[model samples]
Target: MGSVLAFFVLATVFFYNAGNWLVVSHLPQRADAIVVLMGGVPERIPEAVDLYKSGFAPRLIFPDDYEENPPEVLPDGSLLHNDAAKAMHLSSHFNIPDSVIVIVKGPALNTQVEAEIMAIYLADHPETDTIILVSSSYHMRRALIIFRNEFASKGLEITIISVPSRYTAFDPEKWWQTAGDRKTVFLEYIKIAYNLLWDRWF
Candidate 1:
């Protein structure tokens, strides 16, 4: 009983730390650029596009490791490109213009892996500073930890913000409804613990 209760307490803490607290309190209001971490719910597109349309950042960087093929095919059997990629592609349809979004395909891994690539890209560019590190609110704490540890060592002054993953808000009670959701929260909790332990020792 004690172990079970302890588990619940710990789970709640992780959700609270990584959830809306990061988005509402920690997100940077302005930045030199916006780096939207790919792989969130499809709802984030409008938020990213809106940021661009509103001139929050003249450019948007989406770090991906997209293959040559899209994730699926259209209803008529024609190839539908990667939804995230195509959404950015369709931005011109919304009048945001083709010049605003830059898709950077890094490698297959977690956001830390992708952010490392973004950090390197910023390093090479030299002209760019500040970036909104966009991802689902649940992932923001881990993302920012990885970005700050990795990017700062490279001598780049970047600002990260949690642009809430589209159509989703932070709620711990909602996690237990699905097995996938529960597993994700569990894995994230482990990752958070690993990060905390590693930060203290190394």
Candidate 2:
């Protein structure tokens, strides 16, 4: 009975802290650039903007996925291309100037793709040695790992500092209490597992 009770307690603790375990945050520092991972724009973009405005980095790099957001003809007869990339537009609205906004164009379907494309972009712009990586709080761990691996594979020795978005709706302590939080945590775990499998054996 004692063994079973102990197992239950351990399992409960792990489950409760799952959301927190998935987050990887680091203190912001002066870096060459800030790269905000795609998706989680509502939260991630603002966080990246804060970092940029705070002078953590001289510029912000946004991955552009034309496939994910193709050009659409608006009712005004002007071509609207993803509202200048939603993240970029919001950053501008937040007062991040156009001079410091760099767009890395690619088919960024996932976090891995984003990292790969950014690595490619960095290869051309060799000045950007250090980077501040931003993403959703729950998505930071996987994003950081994927980015590190991507840069390593490309033989780039970039210093990456991961910063989880402060604007996330996820509450690590009570993630399971809300439907949205539960779904976010569940999907994040699945993605992490898949990333592990893909990176390790495949």
Candidate 3:
């Protein structure tokens, strides 16, 4: 009974932090740019647009190596996924315009590589300070670790804005039992628990 009670107490703390990390929020009152992680889905693109509209960042940079799954299959050319395309679509819808939106396509195969590449871009253009990292709820914890590591030495003052939402996998409402939700939660549990206990991430 004691062990079970302890477990629940720990679980409550973990979920509270996770909930905070999942939702994207305003930065430290002075922000210059917003960068979105590219696993484009129903969640990220819209979140970025919403941030832009909210005046969180002056510019929105979508840095990615590959276009996600394109809406229509490509014949001989690489194309953008619905998520990526949605960024474009939302930009137009929100009247963000082309100037404030920077879409950098390199070889960002994963989060680490993407961070490295984004760091390089920001290095050259160092004027933009104070950033908001937009990502899914489950991804925020792990993603922030990578983002911090990659950007640590770069000298950019940044704040993370985790956008928690039920995206692309479907049935946003019934996440507790869904396979995707379960998988995400399991991963998140491992990530947060491990990090809290072990102080992982170098």
Off by more than 4 A, model 2? 1-6, 68-80
Candidate 1 lDDT over residue span 25-65, tens digit each: 25446677777776653556666776777777778777765
Model 3 agreement with the true structure over 1-202: per-residue lDDT tens digits? 9999999999977654543444333343436777777775457767777767877778888775565443545565645464445566556766778888887666677777777888888777778656777776566667777777667767765555544433534332344556776566666667656645544544
Model 1 segments more than 4 A misplaced: 1-28, 68-70, 75-84, 90-94, 169-181, 196-202
Model 1 / residue 128 / CA error / Å: 1.5
Ranking by TM-score: 2, 1, 3
User: Which pairs clash in model 1?
Assistant: none
Residue 95 displacement in candidate 2 (angstroms): 1.7
Highest TM-score against the true fold, candidate:
2
Clash pairs detected, candidate 3: 24-162, 65-108, 69-81
Q: How does each model score on TM-score?
A: 0.74, 0.90, 0.69
Model 3 off-target regions past 4 Å?
1-30, 67-86, 153-175, 189-202
Whichever of 1 and 2 has more TM-score, that candidate is: 2
What would the C-alpha RMSD of candidate 1 be, to one decimal place? 4.3
Give the per-residue Cα lDDT of candidate 1 at 197. Answer: 88
Please give the lDDT score for candidate 2. Answer: 0.86
Model 3's alpha-carbon lDDT is: 0.64
